[model samples]
Target chain A: MTDTQNSRDAVVIERTFDAPVVLIWRMWTEPEFLKEWYGPDGASIPIANMDVRVGGIRRVCMEMPSPNGPMQMWFTGEYREVVEHQRLVYTESVSAESGPVLSPTSPGTAGGHPMMTEVRVELEAVGNRTKMVMTHAGVPSDSPGAAGWAMALDKLAANIATNRGR
Target chain B: MTTAIDEDRLTETFAALANSTRRAILARLAEGGATVNELAEPFTLTLPAISKHIKVLERAGLVVRGQRAQYRPCVLDATPLEAVSTWADRYRPVWEARFDRMDDYLRQLRRQEGASEADD
Candidate 1:
């Protein structure tokens, strides 16, 4: 059931790098390389423990500045499949520093469990370059989960009747 | 970056929006401010139950009740909705930046390789 939900709410991103497939794969699998560019600008990965093999666990912490203070978010995932430079798949869960997964009720808050999602990275060699297609599956857009709020809001936006009652 | 207060509000807003009856009431109110009875007309729920839903929406800042009139019609306030949309879109720029950084790193790697080959 969750698998179907994830496929339905997946968000995909594709990028082509002017580098070989081997180098691109390293950027994803190696903690040293991943820490350099895993998150957005101004966000730092303070802790990155990546065991790239299948069934290995990958734990990372992304810290960024917030209005209140410095905010840290922990993500833990297990690699479901690893196909060298060709493909990689994993399941991700957002958790707290102590390691228990958070709930989705309080998004962006410390210790709030955002929905778990699967990520698939497919790398194809294109001459000297590499084409990477990243599919973040099961984003919970409308499932009985965190994304349900966003979906309901969308429905409300669409169903709003502009006709004012006099 | 999102603050804890903002996150709390978002959570409240989502919780308020989770119910189908409340969503229907909000849709009705979006058309125009309606009294509790008017909002309850479409659903099989009792007037008090609809009022309870309105209270939740009001707490979440999604709905506002007029004070000047006796009926106090519930009005839809879309400010929280806008916040929800912004939160949803927050990940896009992050991923874009990550990709751009990766591109830059790849260029640097190629440069080093080219320099090393020339030295050899």
Candidate 2:
């Protein structure tokens, strides 16, 4: 009954790109191609060094121009699965720019623990187009800081149901 | 757009809600306001221990206690729960923007490929 409620904890997006599956796969895996459109419309990803192999390092630094100043973020993850144009899974940590993963007790982190999210992309060829289903959700069970995520994701729906029932 | 303070509060709120006992207390309070002893009836915790949990919920802004010491009823505050729900939506916009850029880049790559083929 809380299927919809559970879905609220994650971001699931499906989009069809105007290209074949191969191209779509490249756009996600390759560094140059990923940097071309990895952040906001105007934001530039200064560095996107990706090794598209299982267990390979995926380090990317996104620099965005904000009114306050230039904001920079470094995301470090490892390629969990590399299925070559079919499915790709990776771990993404929204950490400080080129620093340690902010701790759960770190102030202002809000959600406690660094935001360790998993990104899974599935691609299917549909003629000249490619259908992509991307899921950005909590960290894997084995990942560090994931214990906190388990709490954040698990009780949310029940919490909401309890509160909303009143 | 969640600011620094909101994020701080969310962290606090989540930390408070992380405990099973704390969550149960919140659920119990949702039914109606109750004194510390009344709230502790369903649980196997002591009065001071239950009061400690109530203190956490109060700090998280999830509960408020009455002023009268004789009977300060602990009431559930739905405000922080609202924050949790809203925070769930924080990722969609960022991803949408990134996907928009991905779409544009794909189109541009196609055009570049066509241009190179024309050169051949």
Off by over 4 Å in 1: A1-13, A39-43, A50-58, A63-128, A133-152, A158-166, B68-70, B116-120
What is each predicted model's overall lDDT from 0 to 1? 0.72, 0.72
Worst-scoring 10-residue span by lDDT in model 1 chain A = A1-10
Q: Which pairs of residues collide in model 2? A: A104-A113
Candidate 2 docking class = acceptable
lDDT of 2 by residue, B10-65 (tens): 65676677677887887777777888889999988888999999998999899999
Q: How close is candidate 2 to the true structure, as a TM-score?
A: 0.75
Top candidate when judged by DockQ against the true structure: 2
Error at A108, model 2, angstroms: 13
Model 2: residues >4 Å from true position, as ranges? A1-6, A51-57, A78-80, A95-112, A138-166, B1-8
Q: Which candidate has the top score in TM-score?
A: 2
What does TM-score give for chain A of every model? 0.70, 0.76
